[model samples]
Target: MNNAHYELQDGIAVIRLENPPVNGLSYELRRGIVDGIKKAEADDNAKAVVIIGSDRAFSGGADITEFNTPKVMAEPTLPTVINVLDSTELPVVAAIGGVCMGGGLELAMGCHFRIAHPQTQVALPEVKLGLLPGAGGTQRLPRLIGIEYAMNLIVSGTQVPAAMFQGTPLFDELVEGDLLESALTFAKKVVEEQRPLKRVRDMKVSHPKPEAFFLWAKTSVGAVAKNYPAPLKCVEAVKASIEKKFDDGIKLERELFAQLIQTPESRALRHAFFADRAAGKISDVASDTPTREINKVGVIGAGTMGSGIAINFLNAGIPVTILEMKQEALDRGVAHIKGVYEGRVKKGKMTQESAEKKMGLLSTTLSYDDFKDMDLVIEAVFEDMGVKQKVFETLDATCKPGAILASNTSTLDLDKIASFTKRPEDVIGLHFFSPANVMKLLEVVRGEKTSKEVLATSMKLAKKIKKTGVVSGVCDGFIGNRMVGKYQTEALLMIEEGASPQQIDKAIEKFGFVMGPIRMADLAGGDIGWAIRKRHYEEKPDTRRLYVADRLCEMGRFGQKTGAGFYKYEPGNRKPLHDPEVDRVIEEVRKEQGITPRKISDQEIVERCVFALVNEGARILEEGIAQRASDIDIIYLTGYGFPVFRGGPMLYADEVGLINVERALQKYRKQTGNPFWEPAPLLAKLAAEGKTFN
Candidate 1:
């Protein structure tokens, strides 16, 4: 009696789901729904039953926390609750308003008819979390929509707008007004006309050759999924619907869902999903801090980094003023911005009109007078302390009072940049990844004197620009590039010690990196690394040198732009063309170091490259540069091209076991005699105690 809310209107039974916030189908809500259906079935006066939700959303999905609990997996689960809705003899109509996802969609599918408002979103996003539709979703979706569309939706886990279902058989009617009134009207029409019940499971599979569906799905599964078993397993579950009986398909889906829940990929993906959400919560900053609203922004550079940062602000509907010293440089920057926007237009991502509108948001100027009244100024000049300090001093003198000052320094010190300005409290780092408009990770560096207000304002601006803002303390390379330098150094050393560049690249590529170390270095331009190395040497000449490869840069082999670095590249194609010249250079370097060439295994190469990064990440964590291990994972997954299926470096380390990693590092340290291979103390302690980063 407590579970069901019975209301009689005319001769119809009204059952409203009384749960809050998307009506997540918890254990109590499931039982309440079942009892509501039973009440409608037993009432003689109720000619029809109309089920609706009081909240904006019908239901979000099954409770995520319930998945780990034992009580949920027992008898009378979600499937049983769906069965009660399916068994109702009277005409039943479901009124859906907001999000109807997962179990919410399953409940609507069981109804005799469904009506929804124009703003509702429908999806089965279980595949994103490494799961398939368990409660009749696999069996019913294909029956409502065809096999091809159903497979794509379930496999990709994409949500579609409710307007797309207009005039489709999936939804009975698209309501413009109240969802309940529409449901009631539809129910009255159905009862009066004595509409026949159409069960999804009873519908025959529409494909002419069902075997072809399985074959195509299998091909797609192999190409996209590679070694990961979850996506392929999802394909198999969907295939069951076309190949087997409805009940058999449901059983296969359940088995696959249960198996995937225990997989490393699923666990890692779930961790990543929640980690991204958790990054927004900062304990240091009060929620009440006044966010410096960024309307008009200024970028102090015209190079690649500055132009990309300006593009992001423009794309976000914020006006930008790109300041450069020379008219020729300003013209080149404008041309580059137009080219980038034109590429987007060519790909059908944006229209020509929209591109022109975005370009109109940008105003190029040569003087700091144009920066007046700007809300934020981001300095993205060359990585030099004097050049950066000059820009900061100029910005401090010209910018509007209380305007947030940001620097886009990848590895330079933020505290030193703040030292040049009188308002050190306002100076913060907004280190966007290369090609800032495309990359999602934005390292928000907080200097020693950076105020909490400035930190909060920087994060707010990062979110506004559609970037994941990860806060980091001041360090040489901050968090990402610092760890990357160590990883890249290890890969280069491996090449010096007889490992082939292609072999090393292939090993890590197999481990889910988009490209290997040498290939990535080539793509990012060798000049950048050369510049950083030169700066490092100039600043501290006596600081332990680790055999630099100056020959590559001297020969003008500055990666893909110059067509050669550690590998050769063809114009217009990203594929690496192995060069005999590079091999000769390696041989000459190897002789200079007096190293005997030895064969290197793929296993050893992967361990050296990946574990080196993980080891450095541990050091960053120990130094308090990174707040959490998950934050490091987020940076790699979003910023770097680290594969999502394996999670990030930290997750991979946990999977490999710290003890095994520490042993490898110790063995390599002794063999190579490189101080960089010294395992981090936290890594050693974790290995000794047999613990994980989590």
Candidate 2:
């Protein structure tokens, strides 16, 4: 019931923040801190006040639950609470441990003294949410530490250990012992010595060559600020700490925070922040559902995907046994994993001893017998159904009774794959993105018959392996690929209609995609999309054709692997070069189709490609393929290189306005005469009602 507890011991008053998970400095906690300080002031015997929190967190930051609500800016706001602590006559000591960040650090700096655990994670992470620290963080931090360190910490939103600031005024003492004990002893000393109540606001912040330094900071931050304006604003706010008085700096910080939060870029980043957390929850599955243990993992095949999957388990300290059809293949897989660890070692990302320890958890096998003891077996074999069927059949017979049988199939029918095993309830799809170990997405495909227990465990395992697992119902290509198909198709169609591959790619990249679809196709190997299209041509005879892509593949131009596709690459260099041959090929296809090429604007290119994804994502949401609109955003943001600032295609569509999106779809549908451009029913409905997806 009490968010903060008040106690008195030997003339010392202690205010212990009691919010669980993380003392997030909620209104209640803020009031409690103020009330405790008041109580300390009133007590004749209380000589000093000590503020503390649990070892897990002195405070993580602002209470995210209160975000976007009036509660966040209610009376006794973070600044008000900090101001209370700052003006208090008695010396206040902040005993910080574990995580203390954002307004939490601001609160600590408001105190007269700070004693922290050496490993306490300290940060002013508001810039990550597209805002500067609004509560004296920029003003006080530069005063405690130098301008340079404060600039880096506030702008980057990166966490540094308290030990890193050992000799700095940020932490009066870095304690390796019990935090509260050190704080109580320090408070006693402060009382005995009658120490002055130090205020960070009174401290001066100076920077040599202030104008030149700030000019360089702006230029450096500008280069990476991209579509997000928060980083540069952060620089401005930090510079103000030196240029302006303390209260004036605080006012400037508030102004910048307000301006940044209202920007579309900041809104998108905030949406993405919430969307990632939302993806981890499954509505039908209770949070308390029991999950099966996955102490040992078995990975089928020894190719790139399989080896990468095995490395995830090995890195998680879970023993992984990789099965390959041949000993030579097994040897190559093992060697590839070793080389990856060796690369990390050489780069100093990890020590050789640590790499060796991870490798020690990895073992190779030639048969399924080794999988019997595996609690979870993931098959990363060929994507063909026949190949998957055989792997599932073998695993069905080989793995133990409760073992989770997962397939890393990207587009295959998960239900059919599950049918290969009698225990269909245990079969689920753990679709890892390419370079499985590197990419963050893991689409946990929940089949028609997947048990709740298995689904819960699969989600848990995804987190354990450090992947953003988004749940998807059974559907061809599931969520990410299904939407990406439309995205890439629009790009190809634009090329057919006259836009160059480079032009289309540049437009999308300019819109903030990590890579353009045409360049992405080249990087992913054009043959892969060509093969899928061939399958589509057979399965859906009336499917819209992408002739130019097929013609390029017909010429044996796969991608970077084949030294050419839509673009050519120099040996040992991944940069794609302009291939005049590809231009000629595009012309030939256009002539064959009797299509007249028209110059397309970059705006058209971006809208067509991005809105194509938005329309398909609408359909996916309508069909219940994706749990919510945000899940689609998460999949695209993490796996498909959708711009985080745009909050992925779905959220971007909402930001663009559903009615506007519907209008664009109608315009493109008529202009292009492509049936795929037709607005999805849900999109039209939402637009008619003037509602957003999220």
Candidate 3:
């Protein structure tokens, strides 16, 4: 009874949905709604009816938790309750506010008329969960808004403001304030003027060329959807409106919804959604740990990484101070930021005024003297530990006592950097991915002496900057790059055994990688891997080492930036072109090693690269460096361009079976005699037992 609040005033029945926190359509709430509508229809005092919510949001959608439970899916259906609301003789008006999504929007479409607040937004986001709208949404939305707009909304799962609905015949009226009062006024107008009620399902499809719309939709959604089945199913639901009768279309939608609910893509996408929400939870760090409120930040470098990090802070409305040793370098960094903003403006992502406002937040200087009173300072200089340590030492003396100190070191030791600081507990690692502003993953490394307050503050700051922060204990390469190193080394060894760079690249790309390891190295610059390789050789000299490809770097053939590396690049175009010189260099290296390279199959190449990463991930999990397998999956999907449709490397491995992965590793170990091919003990044990990472 509490879920539904009913009152009769002046021969008008007002029914309000009272479920708190977005008013998700739960089982009890549905039953209460059906009973309330029947009571209003039978009462002589009630001449008409109005349905709305008590507070700001009308409804956020169906209770997502309900999908995980068996009771809701197995018990009394949602359609039965929806039919009760739709069939009532009295006129029913939905007064919507805030977000009306999923089943909430379906309920609104069932009403005779909809009155929305000016700021209200409506969407059916079922596609995000790999399900189509089940309860008359796919059938009704097209009827009310037409095919094109409806298809776009369903496919993208994007919401629009109520203002866009203005001048549209679907909405009866747009209300400004006090949604209940506006609903009552509209209800009285309908009764006094004897207005005819219009149901969305009863309306016919409206389009000049219905077949052309269907053809265009199939082509557009198919291109973007790839292996995912939800987008194409959404198109089928829309096409059903034109091809089938109203009730028949609803039946088709229900059938498709049930089928999609059982797909592996749906389960994976839903798992990802829940995993993202769960990533914010940190049990070791107290919830109330005091955070250093960062209103202004200072950056110690003006290179690519530094500029990209500055753009992230500026976009979040935090003022930034960038410092470079040379004035020319400072000018270039500023120009790069401006160019990025101008491109965004041209694409209508931002207005010129908005771009200027963000730019105004940035301040540049050549010395540390201008960094006074800054709440946080991020050092994004070279990869050398000595350079980073020197920056930490300078920042320790320059920054205020309570300010947070962070280093953007991808592979350097955070504990070593903390050792140089007077307040070692305040130092942390904020490893932003390359092209920092665009990449969503941020590895927040906690040094051995890192304080709980520092960890909590970094997590909160990641949310403020709109990035996914995964807390990682300090180790070599933290989480992502540490696993990446194992995978990349295996790929290079494959090349030594006669797999061409193109073959390796093509194999992984077919397996759903956005780019192969060799091409990624090209884009990141060949010098980066060469430098890291040199450092590794210095630290662990006894390990079997691959011959260095120094000619590429010595000739200034860095990568796409230098127009050549593993592959040749045309100016202004980043596409890879084969070069015989690179192949000749590789052949010479193979000859020096006394290795007779043979032709490698595509399947062998994919398993070597991807399984290597998954095998390393298992090691990380056993060592407790990563909290969960899903955490690694989220990191790869967001940062390393692992295809989302395939889930992630870990998920993909699970799909392929753990035993198969172990067998592949064993086969490689026997063939190559490389110690790195030794299947992780955990992986071998799990595979033997037929268990999975989950």
Best of the candidates, lDDT: 2
Cα TM-score of candidate 2: 0.99
Q: Each candidate: what lDDT?
A: 0.84, 0.92, 0.86
* lDDT ranking, high to low: 2, 3, 1
> In terms of TM-score, which candidate is stronger, 1 or 2?
2
How would you encode candidate 1's per-residue C-alpha lDDT over 1-694 as one tens digit per residue?
Answer: 2333668787888888776767777777777777777777778888888888764788887866566687476545888877777776888888888888988898888887888887788899888877778898888888777788778878888888777777766788888887777787888888899998767777766788778778888897779876567678777877777789988988888898889888988888887887786666676788898777788999998888999999999999999999999999999999999999999999999999999999999999999999989999998998888899889999999988889899999999999999999999999999999888899999999999988888988888888889999999999999999988888877888788888788989998988898888898898888888888888888989644445356789889898999788888888988898999989998998898898889998988888888888999999999989888899998899988888887889889999899989889999999878777799999999989999876
lDDT of 1 at 33: 74
User: How much does each candidate deviate from the true structure in C-alpha RMSD?
Assistant: 2.8, 1.0, 2.3
For model 2, residues 310-425, the per-residue Cα lDDT tens digits are 88888899999999889999999999999999999999999989999999999888878888899999998877888988888988998889999999988889999999999999
Who is ahead in TM-score, 1 or 3? 3
Displacement of the residue 57 alpha carbon in candidate 1, Å:
4.0
Poorest stretch of ten by lDDT in candidate 2: 381-390
Kindly report which residue stretches of model 3 are placed more than 4 angstroms away from their true locations once superposed: 1-21, 38-47, 54-56, 71-77, 192-196, 286-289, 548-551, 554-556
How do all models score by TM-score? 0.93, 0.99, 0.94
